[model samples]
Target: MSKVQKPEKSDKIDNIVGMLMEYEKMTVDLMRKATDTPILEQYDLNAPYAKARIIKEDGQIKYRIDEVTLTDEEKKKLKEIGELLIEELDVDIKRLGSNENAAAYIRKLVERIIKNYKIKLTTDSLDRLMYYVIRDFVHFDKIDPLMRDPWIEDISCNGFGIPIYIWHRKHESIPTNVIFQTAEELDKFTLKLAYMTGRAISIAQPVLDATLPDGSRVQMTYEKEVTRRGSTFTIRKFRERPLTCTDLIIYNTLSAEIAAWYWYVIEKQASVLVVGGTASGKTTTINTLAMFIKPNAKIVSIEDTSEIQLPHENWLSSVVRTGFGVSGSISEITLFDLLKNAMRQRPEYIIVGEVRGSEAYTLMQAIATGHGGLATLHADSAEAAIHRLESEPMNIPRPLIPTIDAIGVQTRVQVGEKSVRRMVNVAEVVGLDPTTKDVLTNDVFKWNPKNDTYVFYGRSYVLENIMKRHGYKHEEVMEELNNRRMVLEWMVRNNIRDFKDVVEVIRTYYVNPQQLLERVKREKMEAPSGGSRPA
Candidate 1:
């Protein structure tokens, strides 16, 4: 603690020490003179001091501290003091980051600055310091504007030197205006992310898929060998508020009539196959539509990534694991594997996230073998959706296609500068021709792009069978359907956005249509434009 007797040779140490203190923006030379002492043999080059802009804006370097020439005196003192500080805090850093490597390191950096100087890390840190000094620096903090952006559904980066891009719910995909200046910088940033997620991104593990603590999905490609351009990362963002059917209707993804009609299809125990091209919003539509199920019904949702968020109390959501515990663990369970497990769970409805391969056969067999099922697939149309399921790996039987009660196809379309997606087609799988092995389908509703709205009430052939099974006269069903439509319009007018209310109204109508219609007319009046009544 007393002046650690600085020898004449310590002058060189004091000079470097002054440079370290200056870089870190500290002013005291008394704390920096230990480097000039013969003890220099004990420590290597003073820990690289990530200091402020060495050369000021006006091109003046503060080479001297308090009128002391930087010759040998100030140099050794500054280097000695700075090394002790960095090395000591480096210990504090190791402790803080024992569990959270990168985050804890960042935290320790911030804490040390706050503890040593009166500087708050939010405004000061080596990370930010180096960001300005280092070439190709892009500030992508977790709390950046991109994370707060409501429209951004995903964030992706191929590597540094290229712009980062994001998929907006409204705009689809657009450049984020954030770019890394160099590949190395991008690689380091991605490494920080990997360490933060407690995953390794290296030559041994070239790929990483993990969720950020905030629930944002992140995928990374390790350096040079794994990805031609050093490193890469992508973030598939989750939404702030899960879109409900009404939200979809308000967004014009579907109309009230279409939503109400689908409610009928889903409520009546019909197997539904939602199909769309990649990123066309199929799973989302299925998630939204699933709100129609009876809350008491047992639903099992299976997926590789747990994306489907069903709010029903009786739902049991399951996700498949590549393997468990440790390395050498067999990659056993898959969507198909879960399907077999789902059957034994006594689920009234099996909701597969998507039928990419043979899982389609299980979904189809479930539908045909007296169990109602709901699933999504990557296909553009009803026929294509079926073909994808029936051909090759899936090889679902043509006859079983009819067992699929309906097909819902969603697609992305241009709506001005922004892109909007909607359920473009809904088809009812009516039957199969035994002689020709051909499947018959009826288009229930479709989006009429000319009108920019989905056409509903296109005579659901499946609804006819439902009516027959219920032993209701055809005339009664037509009246009931029309009456339910009026009630829905009234509910929409009355600001009844709750699907639960819709279920209630539908349930009442099912019990006694005439009474509910009379009661609604006597209570909730309808407006001419057919929108939900304003509160």
Candidate 2:
């Protein structure tokens, strides 16, 4: 039989190619016809891999994510091939660097497997198969589309069997069509999340608080250990491009006047504490206001989980590190530790993402030492914020309270049928009363609920101090405020809402105010009447 010589290498390669070609032909022949699901709105989250649709079902609006659907035969093949691939494929995913690179690597391996096994699949089917594989291995699997949706601010899964709810930018909290059908499924997903964050989650240590690779804040509990239900998770998505001061003005979160006032105070290196309830946009306001800090000033930011984003080149960002092995271990780094280190760094500005525990005292000390402080507090009003600071945990002395220049009270309130965030009060910390020993604050701006407008009290102690320090007369300061207001309005009108663009404009004004102001005036004059204002 001539020893039944094994197929030559070239012949073997040709055989694989021929087999793939034949499989492609078979798949083309077996292709099945593939939604008029009442889509109110639809958009691609990740083109070709996933899409999101706002649909109405049984009189309820729901967010539905549509991904590639496979036939039963294809699904079975995918499972078999995936198991084999996982067992045999040797890849150092970390060495791949990015999701795109890892995806390409996975695709190559899947293709090699298909060729070796002579798996029957068309090009389109292979593409679909690769998407699921990459999604499960490199992304968040079923919720990957939700993770890609830019309009979603928060995603929460209370437990297995419960529909995932997303906090949509336009629709508020709405249920999505995705759910974890079994406790084991959610446990696996929770474990995957922990692994992604380079942490561990188990029945012994169930709680997990971590920042995702994309900077989104995530808190999870594993396998019904601490939570009453199954594994639970809440993700607060981070914006790639942070909101600018102009964005707040456009959202009516604060008036342009308030923004200009903040610009003036921030330029003067005044300490500000933004206080609000949950999801009231406190951190957002501080992050926006931080852009007004002089471009060259040395700044340090400390956070439990990184949320503050700035455009300053001379900025240092730090986040608390959870300890390994046990709580309060030496390896752990707390906000208090970071704040102390920030003081040693001699930063001109110290930004605390949120002042919750003992770190509040360190921040107060930094502010007292004349480091410009920016922070957020979970409180309803200026008084409440002061009380919290002076109480236990924070325990900031009354004398240190006045070291904070202003308290911006932000709140989310109902406007018509929708909830809107507004800076309800901008109070200047005048000082502690000699007799009463109470922290006195002058309300510079107060939001009027009736007309949905902000009323400036016509006088700001903070602005007055700024004027004195800068040697500006009252009239000159007022004129300067108007100029800044006009500049901000011009930016809003010109749609210069990008964080970096806003920073450039502010920096340009600092370098050459006349040049920028003249440009703004010229643009305003050249525009058609009423066209220079934002709609």
Candidate 3:
């Protein structure tokens, strides 16, 4: 990859590090406007220095400009002249001090002065010209394939000795050639990120974890204490536009029919758990499912790395801090601690990004409190998911498992040309075996690898049990399922999905079925699209 070379710091103190990048741009523009600043008449890329000539007040001299040194007087003159030149051409005065504040760097400049026997510009003036040449250089221009990368979910560095690795959407994890020039530079960057988050990362606190200004989660271990390298940092990039449920439908990640039934459950305030292997789209699934929640419902989401994004305004997002053992401050609340506090907040719904440790017990206790909760977990199969919940670390008792509304096991299978990933099993916990502890999950839909399709064992038995709990007749339950499935299919067909309409239908249907169904019929009469109105 060709790196787009740029100055590390701009002269515009608004640039970064109290420097001024804009001043450079203004100078170039002035030079360009004054005499149409001529490009070097002779140029060579391979060599750092090539024959380039410029007219100074003294005269002209052939020399490579970038490496030239100037006396104090000439430096002051460069600053004076550059300022006057840039002011002639207007530039955005506001953005001149954005990142590191480049304005502080305007101390001096190089100027052409009278020389022996004649007026001519030498290497000193040429240095000034070269500095003005490329002031618009945005920091990190050269290795931007790694910086501005769209799919890079994570950027990590173990220290100055190793290359950076990025987690891309399609490429998964790939190493980049970007390297810090020194260990001190790497440490400064880590401290900067911690500083941005109002946290500290230093040798006194060898380990540092905090969120960057751009919302990327960062963690760094300093010197040989934590790792063999001097210092290493990892940045988990947050998605700019997270994939919504509609995107899932279009991507074939899940079927519209299943999504429709789930919408009904969500509006009913069903507690759900999403299970998947690493990189199996677990977090995305949690984020997409959050859309089904009632718009006004109060939601509190806790995470070690902030990942879940809800469209609702009534939501609180929190992340855990770790102990400063590795080198930094060890002042972070445990997930268990956050969960206890969340209970007091009385959130209508509680979301844990990924559950581990004692928090599982309190989170389960919250579920028993009648608050709707949504979370994701790492497990291969539905049974495995249950075991992980009931086993040692999580230790969620088997009896309490009934409080969970559904266990969604997302899986991937190879289908000829490419690997196809899907929400293979959406199992409902009707009732567990009293004696044997084994969960009796009715896998509603299973992928048939041979045909490269799914076997939708239509009309979930799970729906029947839940409907009975609500005092609905068998016929009423079946009719409601078909009704929702229709809206879902229509959403898939007409691309009229946003989940808000679907959730409204579910809520209305659950609280009062007759009024909403009747409205759907009456609205269908004058419907312009010829499809059912989920409203």
**Predicted structure 3, TM vs. truth:** 0.65
Q: Model 2, 1-535: lDDT tens per residue?
A: 5678888999989999999999998777656311334668899998977899898766777998988899998899889888978887787675788888988888888889999989999988888888888888888889999999999999999999999999998878899989999998999999989888877888778899998888898999988678888899999999999999889998899999999999988888899999999889888889999999999999999998889998888999999998878553759998888988888899999999989899988888788877898999999999999999989888988898889999999998998878889999999999988999888999999999998899999789987887787788999888989999999999989989988799999999999999999999999899877665454
TM-score of each: 0.70, 0.91, 0.65
Considering TM-score, where higher is better, how would the candidates rank from best to worst? Answer: 2, 1, 3
Summarize candidate 1's per-residue lDDT along 353-390 as a digit string, tens digits.
Answer: 87888787787778777677788888889999878877
Q: What is the C-alpha lDDT of each candidate?
A: 0.67, 0.89, 0.66
Model 1 whole-model lDDT (C-alpha atoms): 0.67
**Top-scoring candidate (TM-score):** 2
lDDT order of candidates, top first: 2, 1, 3
User: Who is ahead in TM-score, 1 or 2?
Assistant: 2
CA shift of 409, model 3, Å: 1.9
Positional deviation of 319 in candidate 1, in angstroms? Answer: 0.7
